[model samples]
Target: MSSSIYSTRRWRKLRAAKLALQPLCEPCSRRGKLVPAYSVDHIKAIAAGGDPYPALDGLMSMCVSCHSIKTNARDNPHAFGKGWKAAFKGCDLDGRPLDPDHPFLASSEG
Candidate 1:
């Protein structure tokens, strides 16, 4: 989905209200952290047949880092698959990901 939808005035108002009500990141809270929420994420992702302007039923507070992780997971489900996970275990934890073919490995050839 295009991010332009989130730039709408209506969405801005809703996002403000959502952040005010829940200032803390929902996922971080669940993981026993207390980081402030920086964005209002759609609980049901916009790419997965979710409504662009969904009601409050499909929204939650998120930090930027957590939001990125969530988005990456949704966009690349195959990366979390059994074989992929095993392959990912061999990757350097601190390396920048340069390989387009492997989600976790950073290709030195690049």
Candidate 2:
């Protein structure tokens, strides 16, 4: 939580990349909507011992809400059972699997 995802060259690169690709958000793309990119999430996290880029296959773009969810899960593994190991398992604050595509699974490929 202290020194993870939030601080990374990859995130910086991703933020710029997202703008290059589209100013809109990815979820909005799926919904046929166009919204600004508030956060470029890992779709995976670091504390969970993940490599964001490799895990998501380069799908590293999310909004602030999305990014925070991933960050929370990564920061609180003990609160979750089995550590919620998946590349696309978004859950509530409690850590129960939410929408599989909620965008928090890219933490690692292992």
lDDT of 1 at 38: 96
Alpha-carbon runs more than 4 Å astray in model 1: 80-110
The top-ranked prediction according to TM-score is 1
Tens digits of per-residue lDDT for model 1 on 1-110? 56788889999988888888899987566556799999898765577666767776467788887676656655788644443233223323345331123533224436
User: 26 in model 2: Cα distance from truth in Å?
Assistant: 1.0
- Listed per candidate, the RMSD to the true structure in angstroms reads 11.9, 7.7
lDDT of 2 by residue, 1-110 (tens): 63564568876676677666656665444444466667665443443455654433444455565455555655686744333334233444556444433334333234
* Cα error of candidate 2 at position 65, Å: 4.8
TM-score of each: 0.63, 0.46
Q: What is the lDDT of residue 66 in candidate 1?
A: 67
lDDT of each: 0.64, 0.51
